[model samples]
Target chain A: MTAQPDHPDAKAGHTLISVDAMGGDEGPAAVVAGCALSAQANPDIGFILHGPQEQLDPLIAKHRELAGRCDVHHATEVVTMDDKPSQVVRTGKNTSMWSAIESVRSGEAAVAVSCGNTGALMAMSMIRLRKLPGVNRPAIAVLYPSSNPQGFNVMLDVGADVRADADDLLRFALMGTSYARNGMDLQRPRVGLLNVGTEEHKGRTELKEAYDLIRAQGESTGFDFVGFVEGGDISGNRADVIVTDGFTGNVAIKTGEGTASMIGNRLREAFKYSPLSRLASLLAYTSLRRLSKKIDPRRVNGGVFLGLNGTVVKSHGSADATGISAAIKLAAQLSENKFNDKLAARVAATLPAEESPS
Target chain B: MTAQPDHPDAKAGHTLISVDAMGGDEGPAAVVAGCALSAQANPDIGFILHGPQEQLDPLIAKHRELAGRCDVHHATEVVTMDDKPSQVVRTGKNTSMWSAIESVRSGEAAVAVSCGNTGALMAMSMIRLRKLPGVNRPAIAVLYPSSNPQGFNVMLDVGADVRADADDLLRFALMGTSYARNGMDLQRPRVGLLNVGTEEHKGRTELKEAYDLIRAQGESTGFDFVGFVEGGDISGNRADVIVTDGFTGNVAIKTGEGTASMIGNRLREAFKYSPLSRLASLLAYTSLRRLSKKIDPRRVNGGVFLGLNGTVVKSHGSADATGISAAIKLAAQLSENKFNDKLAARVAATLPAEESPS
Candidate 1:
């Protein structure tokens, strides 16, 4: 957990970013290449790369931009995709995933980004960074591509924890609101509680209780409460921030992704069906590219660990260099904006638990 | 609630299908037109129409196929979309929805089809026809367009009861399997319990319990249990029938629909970007049309209420004539197969509750 002397206290204006260069579906090569992409894009950012030093050094050396900006942490062990979260926490002391979070926990890195096992990353994050004050459970917030003017919306509790009580859902609303404001640059994000229906009497008793709590916090929290929104509204323009329990949120996002993938496949098949259509595909190349870009899953890559003491962005396991770059961009933005500090202060101030004697 | 004498007991081979002619967004005109389309396509199907006599007579008269075949039931009241299920059950005795279900309950119609409030339809169906023995909860089964050979898969508990216990999910598995067999004509259908992940130790406690229960019933119940499936597998080829609690299933389906709708819109926008692209759209017209029809929501419009004494198909509230016709087609198919009888028998035989002491 000791700080690397090479980074040298972020070099005045430089932002030190920690990254796990192993455990992704793509090897340390893609991860190191991704770090180089982030390094080349911004001169203000420096990297603390965690993996086998031998495997990471060559990849980092190949990129001129990362030659002097990168620090290699020698982590011999790798926490695999199949490894259980609890198992990883106990045995993952020498793993790259643990060392990456350790940099953020030690305050040597402004943010930590990993394309590793999500469950293990979250588990390690909670243990190392700990929960923010007035937080019972942490949540994973992701940017969902939407029809909004910003072209994306914030959704929370994608899978940090499967269960969320009424109070926990209220915390997600506030956390999501903060994410939209600082993470996405929304001044006053509109928040909505995800429910089976928009009606007041619909869904479980816990959801109804959460609805009232979120609505009550609207005026004071400086965010618009859109009452209850359904699954469709997760991508709709109605709410800038969508809040739900991890179980439903996880299912909703995956369903959206699967549907998007299916439609994209069908579109390609449609274009390949006939000779003339194939030619047409060539003619409409730019337009099709534009559409694909608009709905690209990689464009909105990164699941942020919310309600934690420090910022952590969990990239997709199979993320390519581009996807990894997207996640690093998010982490840098959050670090620069000091999103975690603002979120923690907001949670402590607004949480009903702070006001009550429980 | 008496059967009209003019129909004369389904004319030996004719299937008497009841339908609510009001409450849909398009009104009674679309419903009658849809009935005409179904009646025109199928020779052995007769409709016992529900609505006001004056309002229904002209619509029925407009379609020559229903000249002597359609029997009208005078029910002045209509269940509006805003009306609650409990309110409808108490004061909706004269409503068309009630009359439509009554026809099925009174043994005059093989199946009941309604494009009204779903909650009301389910409540009325449960009260009128009642639940089959050993069935704790009813489910709404829907067909999702997928990569399967049948081009679709069955998903149940779409929005029947929001909360489903482990036993209820097991019931959903049986009912979904029955639906896949009879409705989609898939023998030895593969069933999967929907979860956040396919891993054995993921999701809620009820889900894990449901997984073991469903897997145990595979051999005896005649279903190929593929174990736990994630949201992505809802449209994947891994399983023909996906089972889950109504809350998660409802969200998953709606999210899929929303994503599909967004993709379709983006594709149109892509084609209309420029004059040359417009020409390309013209050349690719047939291929694109084929793709659209394949993913068209109307093509799989009906949501069948399972675990009831009689089958009831709940069509989309915003359905046009085409959507209504699709729902009617599904109702006819289930009626012809005697799907409700088989489902009831299946539940009585396979339910663990049937074998255990209370």
Candidate 2:
């Protein structure tokens, strides 16, 4: 029931990406629509869509560009978002997420993009692709739109594991720097260790140890080590790469998102309070639109799983076609840049033999 | 050398607050001005100002209400902002911060207010007043402006100690509940334990244990226990009191503040983008002003150090007269409500004999 690319022109110099089209909240239709949007924008991008073939084929056929590029791979199961990671690891062999990662492992695809459960995706990716040699733990690197010159800062270990020791944090720094360099095109990304305070004597004991380890590897890693940075610096231009344990990073990311949305909603209410204010909103609509675009979460919807043998981008599960397209575009860019190999080289070069994962 | 209160009427039925008028970024003049503002608002509030008499007398003289209400206590030394907690404990016996806490210790004032170094203030408060019986580590409770019916949610351990065991967290819950009851006048506040997720089986090991402990004591402690909450819930209306370890709570608070300020600055830029927007801003100026006042940090500028025998409110070091007055008002209100006695009683009642501080 596969939807094969019939046209020979679609195969010319194209890079294939495996996408899990089943588990997202928007279902296969949105996934197909997003693929169509991505294919329209990037002529050389193709997708191996993993889902129920009968369900994906009809949606894929609606868009001529997607029909010429996407090939459906029939997957029997879908990983429910509520499924435990342990449960998924034990019995999620034939799921769409697993099949999507399998495409990358089999060298049939350059990368895998998923809008599924984060825990299941990470578990399947680890078991299938395995961790890179000498990498202690894999991290989820998110591009935070910032006031930096690069327009975005790389923050890692967003939710890979709830814990990180000194060695794990150092690895995050190396991997994050590589991400900023390869993905965002920064030559020397300044790395800042996230903490409660910028003082040397503050925060947990592990943070202090991680600070020393990161400082020692700054020269070898080819990234400038800016000392400790507070939560405020995550959006500021103080650093290009912010590294923290998963718990702190995850909470901080959610906090920032919640705050932005809350402020946006309040601003809208202010503009609609009265007739004159509504008229003012009409007159200032263009500037407000520009401001909205600058902070739009859809523009940066991908979270790259670093320290893996293959690149994987996890889009928000409930993302619309615009957000999914953004994730697909990010996956395509990372694949074109050969981000995984460079990240591996960077990790192996900076991490000493003694500190390598067993 | 002390500025004696010549007016006898200032002493009648007034609540005295010991204030460290030095070591803030704005200097003693701002402190004096703030005290004057508070004095103007609350006629029954008096201050035991700790600083050099020469420097304090001139500023106190500027406001007739402040001059009549303030009694100067000459202290030869001042604790600098950069002074370590350990260093302050070792050699800061004669400093103004020490003198301010001493006033509370000697029963001359109901509570102490300081804008000095947080670590130093906490250290001095613990040493002078000591932790209440059955309380292991005292916590600093902050009032976050929220959408709750009370207009704010009480969050504890904002930057006290970075570590918290199950017992310490349980104690924080008790103290925070007491704070809301007395300080904010909530009859029965809903207490929430902050975690990375709302699920029963999420976050660190200690959080799970703390959740069970808090849940068990919900009826006895006179508050509803909302099991788990994420960072987004801090500013929401789900709970009135949010309890977490100092490290996570501190980082979360700073993260929220930073995000709000960043968005605020960007919003200002959007409104000033063009001549039309500038004109729009002019028409929508009143609504925008109301919105700004609602989120202004100054209106809620005090972080109360709970679990100590005496109450200590730490104002922002850079607080202006309005912010300082807000902090002073908080201290005065807590004194009027007998918050310290109520908090101590609450801790003594909830904590088992085995868990009591030695």
For each candidate, how many residue pairs have backbone atoms clashing (under 3 Å)?
A: 0, 0
Candidate 1: fnat, from 0 to 1?
Answer: 0.65
DockQ for all models: 0.74, 0.65
Per-residue lDDT of B156-251 in model 1, one digit per residue for the tens? 899999999999999899999999999988989999988888889878898888888888899888989999888888878999999988998888
Per-residue lDDT of model 2, residues B1-358, tens digit only: 1234664224557788999999899999999999989988987788989999999999999988776678888998999878889889989989999999999999888799999999999988998898889998899999987778777899988889989999999999999999999889998999999877787867889889999999999978799998898888888888999999898788778778877887777778998999999999888888788777777878789999998889999999888888889999999999999889988887887776455443
For all predicted structures, in order, the TM-scores are 0.96, 0.95
Please tell me which predicted candidate would have the highest TM-score against the true structure.
1
Off by over 4 Å in 1: A1-10, A352-358, B1-5, B8-10, B352-358
Root-mean-square deviation per candidate: 3.1, 2.7
Best by lDDT: 1
List candidate 2 segments past 4 Å from native: A1-4, A7-10, A353-358, B1-4, B7-10, B355-358
Worst 10 residues of 2 chain A by lDDT: A1-10
Clashes of 1: 0
